[model samples]
Target chain A: MSQEKSLLNKLVFSLQCLPGVGRKSAQRMAYHLLDKDREGALRLANDLKSAMDEIGNCERCRDYTEASLCEICRNEKRNEQTLCVVESPADVAAIESTGSYTGKYFVLMGNLSPLDGIGPDEIGLNQLKTLVEQTDCQEIIVATSATVEGEATAHFISTIVQGVKDKQVSVSRLAQGVPIGGELEYLDSSTLALSLANRQSI
Target chain B: MSQEKSLLNKLVFSLQCLPGVGRKSAQRMAYHLLDKDREGALRLANDLKSAMDEIGNCERCRDYTEASLCEICRNEKRNEQTLCVVESPADVAAIESTGSYTGKYFVLMGNLSPLDGIGPDEIGLNQLKTLVEQTDCQEIIVATSATVEGEATAHFISTIVQGVKDKQVSVSRLAQGVPIGGELEYLDSSTLALSLANRQSI
Candidate 1:
């Protein structure tokens, strides 16, 4: 009756449901999947289903994991005394690929955003503090983004962890690994810049 | 041991899995999806799933249908004596969008690609012959692609469908709405050559 077009037009209409996708790209992706990669196109469907079914945050560090602990947390080779904290599971994955940081990671899952009503509890800050106290961690490197929320989160964690015991836990942020206000996740998709950019004594 | 970049990287990789989508376009698509519309991305994923689920070939005409008969085959007003054969459901959708055609349709599902181990049976040519023999189809339109496989298929189908005795089936083709060596699915998505070119009478 009213002609925006057919179901195909309506079908291609919702290309923006995927993260980091848009109108033209959505159309391109829809056409691409429907037109050529029938099997791979089906894979996208499977991915969404699997992600909905299996993807969950690590209960301990709040990173995406299929099990209770992510592969990083399960690894016994990592130094339990030195723990690196970051904003997202993606960030943890980025750090792990460098092979330089043998220390374990604690993912924040989200930064402090009071306006969005995202607080310490929502992002598992309590779990992080518990992990720090339970483990033999002497130093906690806060590698949250340099944004206001990231800075605020790191500052909050440092003050709390510092006040916990007479053990005098060391609290430090990443030493210029990120440009001001730039998310660490957006850095180039290569091992080179990620490792080279990571500095000592953060 | 590889860096996990932005959601954009996942987007590009996801889009690259689509048919005929190149890396640059995939990147462009990712930026577009991330920048403007996220719902479109999910819609594409959902669309692929729905189309895969609901759209199937008609039992009689081999046209796309959510039921045994497509809208055209179910329509009492449609010309039952004329059948237009195409290589895919996209072709049927394309023609139906014009609102000009009032005939039935038969979809091959694919062209005959023997090298890839695809044959007439795989693409449902035998069923098409059966449809032609049973129905009082006076005119048959062969609208297969002009590609090597498409031509071979059209030739094969024309031979089988026209060879049936008793009924006078005038087998013609649609040279008007299509271009030479062109794929129907890409007709709308791809760049055009000012392509207001009208069909010359065959």
Candidate 2:
């Protein structure tokens, strides 16, 4: 009984540590590991460890990558003149899955939220402005979220772009209601594609 | 962006390995890991490896354990004169969580399924008979599952117990209406307990 408890405890302790996973779910996972896919579970463990050890953020756009530049950033065909700014790689994947937009991107990585104390500096707003000024980008689209923080970050970027380059970069927001609060990944591919295509000037 | 992808991939991959988890849930978990519990994620990775490396079956009952004798077998207070036989530790736990029944257990580890090529030998039914014959146990309870295989295993145990032991070893079964398709691990504590208390003679 003590040995059984110890085995179960070890599994439960580890499983509960997963993000948002409570005790019950953790137990289910542990049982699943024992009953179903032992090898798959091992792979998952290895995948987790290796991914954490090896993967990093893109220096230019703040998108996820296994190398110095994300695949999109490294792509030569993507337009260098027009840049799309998004909050996360999932957003980038949302845009890319469309196969419609050929424009380049500058990822802000996050939005500005004064309440959360996540300011422009925190989300790399300064880097965004610098990239806009340094590049010959004619249009800079603010693809940040539609949330309050997203709105603030977009406006902040617009203002900073104007101040730095003294040039009017075509700043745009995603068409209204296209995005909910949390994620761009959950959006249907077609909707995300449409949102990118019908993007209007802000 | 590369670095972010590396870390996020681990989180996403790890989460997707959980039962009923999809890409959508994986992304949510990834965000939670980065935003709310980075340290927790690391702990999960480490603990998963450790549990897989350290935990195994109890030598006696074949229930998951970290030692030779399971807790039920080791505890001195538990009745040595009575033995309850079960399919798995999950079953043992279902019984134990109720805080009912003072008898010790003998876990078979699995049911008899001819399709899966799991026979009496596979579940160590002979070993159970040997243990019962050798021990001072006055009563042997067949608390295996209620499925077809479980019934078959129970009959086998009863037949073996009858042939080996000169004294009549009482054979009982946990009651039915436990949601036929349901697993022991998922039953509510009280319901599981009711099933145990109302168990009938086989």
Candidate 3:
């Protein structure tokens, strides 16, 4: 009985590791799985085990994949000359879903936060530089988030990639402006300011 | 590579089985597990598998346990004469946390929802009847939610328990009113009306 209680406790405790899951959410998840969806819970367990054990960072772009190079990095049809740099694999998926960009990606996996000891090296800036120097990558599009760390990471990447000796790689950032469908009144002051300052004439 | 991608996809899909987790949240959780917390993910997987495989409903109260009787049911110190009937194991936990309730519990697993084909039998009302008849239980506290189905279930339980021949068992319900720390302006009319109608003398 005590053993069973511990197992239940452990399940709830382990579920808290997921992003945004607190103790209450964890308990709910555990109870929900046990009570309603044991089959799905089992499948989730198997998938989690296999994914965690097998999936590794892509050698080239640092995106998650079992292979040395991710599918994007290995694809021949993608624009190898244009590399979009972002913080994480979720960002990679977000961009891929747009179906517009045909370029490859360099996933930093995290942005620079020096207070948390996340330096340029920590975010694979060295590998990104190496990729730029070794490949025919002509343009680097900085797609980091608009946050302070994201902006800093983008600036650092631009400096490092441009500093690559004898390389003519052009560096650009994703435009910061009012989001599409955003009401002027509801938009934050900083976003509104950026939109006004970087206004483009039709 | 395709196999790995499928595994990742499966993980994300399985994570959606969790309550309140949608496609976006599931994807985020999968990426988070794969990227930031592999060790935690592995532990969660193991714990999930074990919990799902081993945890079974308590035979007496229908609460989750690997044992035939849950810890609460097996405890000798609890007042067996008074059974607090609740809709789910979560409710049992909630009441237990209050530290006021010292009686045993009868977990209904679900309330009476006739529209969804959930009748008394579906919620183990027959089992509850048998429990009340066989045990030395004197009071059955209906601690189901304040929803329509919960009220109907409470009414049904009260009628059935009262109908039992040769034995007398009192049935009661948790009071409904304005919640503690609730303000008059923010509270709904029904709640305010209930608080007013059930007003106690100071």
Candidate 4:
């Protein structure tokens, strides 16, 4: 009985490792799994173990994959000449869901945060530079987020890619302005200002 | 690559079986686990598997346990003459946290919801009746929730226990009124009325 209680407590404690899960939620989740969805909990355990053990970073784009190349990198019809750089594999998924960008991606895994000691080399920027120099890539789309660190990383990448001696690479960034469907009264001042400054003629 | 993606997808899908987790949260959990906390994730997997496989209901109380009897049931210090009947193990925990209940518990696992096909027998009321008849228990405390189903279950248990012949068992319920620290103005009409009707002398 003591061992069983300890195991239950351990399960609850370990469940808190997930992002956004707290002690209360973890206890609720543990009891829920034990009571209602034991099968799903077991399946989740197996999947978590296997995913953690097998999934590795993609050799080319540094995105998560089991193989040397991710599915997008291996696709033949994708525009290899254009590389859209983003902060993480989640960004890759977000862009893929849009179905608008047909180009390849470069996942940095994180942005440049020098205070936290995350620099160019830490985010695999060297691998990105090598990929750009070795391939026939023509355009680099800086698709990092609009946060301060994201902008800094994008600027750094643009400078490095444009510094390539033998090839000319055009660098651009995703547009920053008020989001579609955002009301003018509710939008933040900076976003509204950016939208006004870069207003389109449409 | 396909197999790995399927595994990752399975992880995300299985995570959604948790209460309050949706597709977006599941995706975030999966990515966060794979990226930041592989050790914690693996430990969680092991804990989840073992907890699911080994944990079973306590034979006496019908509460979750690994052995035939739970810790509370095995303890000799508790008041065997008083048994607290609750709807779930969570209720037991809540009451135990108060440190006021020293009696053994009878977990119904669920309430009597006849429309959902859950009757007295479904909630182990027969076991509770047997326990009362065969033991020297003098009091039965119904600690079910304050909801409609909880009240119905409590009433059903009280009626069934009162019908038991050759034994005198005093049945009681947890008080219903204004919660501790609750303001009268903010409380609902029914709660305020209950508090007024059950007013105690200071």
Report the CA-based lDDT of candidate 3 relative to the real structure. Answer: 0.90
The model with the greatest DockQ is: 4
Error of 2 at A133 (Å): 0.8
lDDT of 4 by residue, B1-202 (tens): 2343676788889899999999999999999998899999999999999899988999899988878899999989999999999988888878888898889999999989989999888899999999999988999999998999999888999999999999989999999898889888899999889888999999
lDDT of 1 by residue, A1-202 (tens): 1131244455556655544556665555555555566677666655544443454556666665546666667778778889899986557656776778898888776789999898889777788778877888899999998788898999999987887765678998876544566666777554337656665566
lDDT of each: 0.69, 0.75, 0.90, 0.90
Candidate 4 CAPRI grade? medium
Better of 1 and 3 by DockQ: 3
Residue-by-residue lDDT tens digits, candidate 3, A8-108 = 88998999999999999999998888888999999999999989888888999998887888888888999999999998988888898898999999999
Off by over 4 Å in 2: A1-4, A177-202, B1-15, B34-36, B176-202
> Candidate 2 or 3, higher DockQ?
3
Give the better candidate number (2 or 4) by DockQ.
4
Full ranking by DockQ = 4, 3, 2, 1
Query: Candidate 4: which pairs clash?
Result: none
Please tell me how candidate 2 rates in CAPRI terms. acceptable
Better of 2 and 3 by TM-score: 3
Pick by TM-score: which candidate is best? 4
Give all TM-scores, in the order shown: 0.63, 0.80, 0.91, 0.97
Question: For each predicted model, how many residue pairs clash, with residues at least 3 apart or on different chains?
Answer: 21, 19, 0, 0
- Residue-level lDDT tens digits of model 1 in B135-202: 87888898887677777887888888878888778888655444678886778632343344542455
Q: Candidate 1 vs candidate 2: which has greater TM-score? A: 2
Instruction: Give residue B39's lDDT in candidate 2 (0 to 100).
Output: 66
Q: What share of the true interface contacts does each candidate keep?
A: 0.27, 0.45, 0.78, 0.71
lDDT of 1 at B121: 91
What's the CA error at residue B110 for candidate 1, in Å?
Answer: 1.1
